[model samples]
Target: MPAPNAAAVPVTADHGSATWRLIKAESKLCLRDKVAPLWGVGFPLIVLIILGAIPTLREPVEGGGGLTYFDFYVPVLILFNLAILATAALPITLAGYRESGVLRRLRTTPIGPARVLTAQLVASFAIALVAMILFLAVAGLGFGVDLPRNPFGFAVAWLLAAAALLSIGLLITALAPGRGPASAIGTVLFFPLMFFAGLWVPIPQMPPVLQTISYYTPLGAGMRAFQDAYQGNFPSILPLVILTAYAAGCSLIAVRWFRWE
Candidate 1:
């Protein structure tokens, strides 16, 4: 009988080609996915264009160190893009693959569940990065919005936030029973998280109590980090710590509970 895990590629072999191919395939699948492409990439760019067209949004945010309302929202939308990819698109697709036995079947091939998971993560990260660049491009060229002043700090914050969000995605996939539940759970998370990310009201405009609460939410901390980067400073330690904690805690739990079949 074939070993169930015959597909688990081991070290000491040049597995780079296989890994690269898997990533390419997964990235193609992500691009072909209607829901993720629509909401994750297209939605954010469209909203950015609309916001840029609004003259009122060009006004400077009070106490934002000369950042326009449009500028503030650029990072919010970036966070939103990541949220959709992580919470909605990723969990749902993986759960569906699980439900349909795709992950289980892969164990019999040259590629295994672990590699597939890595490919999915790479695809999602690539998509998120592309969407972010698109957002910045449209904002900069079409609307004259400046890039983040602290580019290194901005990159750091973005990486941490992505790790935190994607780890949560894996946790959702590990915990949910099937695709439907995963989608439902993701939907339930999407709105409230976006709320804390300042999707509507500016964080500063929020009531003091809510502002205090916001900093504790995932996107809230991420938005704070992005804002600090935009203002030419490293993100505060609190938000970075919060993001790292989430990434570590959730990833450990997800790995503990994740199943192949």
Candidate 2:
């Protein structure tokens, strides 16, 4: 009777069965969609290969504590994977669903638009997790990069980073009018975010001013936490706090503004 913004049916044992189906369907769609796989997984994996083959990148970074360039890149590329999935893959698909009135139509169904949103988030998280493990495997076995020294800390940081990035994607979807604008917004956000994550220049090598700015950025803080894990320590409190703030703030804004049509 109402629209996409309507309150969802309360969850129950049977309702959760529908939830599983939606997530499974979305996972299939995520795989079939060429854009996400190509950029999120394929491109990063390809770059890892090329970077690994370069002998010079194995040299110790100028100010990267004790890490080599290649070692530094392993985590950065992992960040690349998450960024692509969150900014490009997640927002584009959801905006397309809205533009095509798929979300609007869901209001009349037992599984409402909110459930579809949950499914999309689950699917994106699954893909990003796979890509993360794959990248770690390739970098460790193929390139001889060391695994994260603090494995548990690394995982915590990664999951928090994913939550924050996914929330940003949702915010983009909320603000963009259509699929075109969503893609445009995602692309616009991608490069600069990666830059602050130390894609082009290692954070240790950045000028003091830029490094200061990077500390506050979402990916930058995530990278800082990742580096801590890489170095065999738990992430410091400041970066964790910053990441949590971003995740909470962006999710609140996205939930408020998101429209089904």
Candidate 3:
């Protein structure tokens, strides 16, 4: 027989291959769920197209400091896409997996529970990122909204915000006992986050009190950081700190409370 260490190498390689297969399978599942992509990608693009059709929205506005209303909404739509993925789609799928015994069944395999969870998360994250890129392309080519000027800064801020939002998604899954509850809670949280992020109202135009309050919300702070990067400025330290805290804190809570069943 070959040496034990040599035998172990095949096992490790096999495990890695298994993980990739799992990620691909999860990705396929996401794709099959047409509604998820509809809300996560299509809806935002449609809204942007509709908004772009308005002549006034394309022109510079006093409230927007010479940037058109369309310019301000581009980042908001990107964030909105991310939010829908993290809050609505991710939690529901994970919770469904848990409820249907898929996760529990994986416990008996070489892959292990954590690796399976990681695969699912990675798949979902990839989908969200793809949706964001599509949004950027459409915004740039169709609407003439400038891409984020500071690409590196914008990327960092986006990754941090995605982590924070995804952590919140996991936390929601951990607490919700079933798919219905998970979706319900995610939907409830989604609207408020959108409002504070200035989905319906521009952050600059919000009352001073609401603006101050929005600064503390994850999407709110994230929108500010994203907007700043859109205009070629480094994001403020406070919003970065808030994003970090939400990511770290919510991840800890999720891990601590997650149920395999």
Candidate 4:
């Protein structure tokens, strides 16, 4: 066997075709990872269903702006699925790839780390979209939760939220020493994000100071945008700016510090 030359791999190519192939390959790899689907799709759906079954949760509440708890939960679960995929599944997979020398091996081939990273990101986005659809379908049919009243606004907020969370995942993967460390760091961030997203306490019910701070967390800003869209209002500029800041700031730092090995 002969050793491969790092610089021998050509960078130029029909990027469209190459990127599509890379996405397809990453999709297959994602499917093979049982944990991704379990946490990203199944667990969230299961939680939503269980929560929706609560009698009190199914009833409309006055303080909830005339919507049921289930309605509020619809967006919560939507963001929750993406958050799990971004924080828990993505960083672990990318870090593990590096740990297993897959990324290093690709460096000597025509396929480079940038392509693989983009492919993984695209594939993860696709999976999260599927999970979102599943949650909407199940929630609508099983719990009578209404779809977002402002579809376009909902979509914009959703994209911003996804970008912010995915950027954080990349930053974690870039910084962690190994896959285990990456997973631990992601898990540590997840609980706080979820809390601010109103998993344990609705934003309206939180103390004034906590509510102020929650608006600044990525998931908090996301949850606000999602809820606003659900109420047929445009997501406010503040949440949009917050989401953009997290996405751009984390992505910049991640790319600047990223290491192939």
Please provide the root mean square deviation of candidate 3 (C-alpha atoms, Å): 2.7
Ranking by TM-score: 4, 2, 3, 1
* Poorest lDDT segment (10 consecutive residues) of candidate 3: 7-16
In candidate 1, which residue ranges exceed 4 Å CA deviation? 1-21, 62-65, 107-114
lDDT of 1: 0.86
Model 3: per-residue lDDT, tens digit, 1-261? 878688555555645688788888888888897656777778877887888889988889775567898888888888888788778888888888888987778767787645655666787678778788988898899878888889988998899898888888878877777799999999999999999999999887899999999999999989988987988898888899999999899877887777778
lDDT per residue (tens digit) for residues 53-152 in model 4: 8999988888667788788888888888888988889888888888888777777877655566678778888878888888888988887788889989
Write down the lDDT that model 2 would get. 0.86
User: TM-scores for all candidates?
Assistant: 0.87, 0.89, 0.89, 0.90
What C-alpha lDDT values do all the predictions have?
A: 0.86, 0.86, 0.83, 0.85
In candidate 1, how many Å is residue 90 off?
Answer: 0.8
In angstroms, give how far residue 30 of model 1 lies from its true place: 1.6
What are the candidates' C-alpha RMSDs?
4.2, 5.1, 2.7, 4.2
Model 1 C-alpha lDDT per residue in residues 68-116, reported as the tens digit of each score: 8888888999999999998998898788878888777876787654566
Residue pairs clashing, model 1: none
- Residue 86 accuracy (lDDT) in model 4: 80
Q: Over the full model, what C-alpha lDDT does candidate 4 score relative to the true structure? A: 0.85
In terms of TM-score, the best-performing candidate is 4
Which parts of model 3 are misplaced by more than 4 Å? 1-10, 14-19, 109-113
What lDDT score goes with residue 14 in model 1? 57
Candidate 2 lDDT, tens digit per residue, 219-251?
A: 999999999998899999999999899988988
- Position 27, candidate 3: lDDT: 81
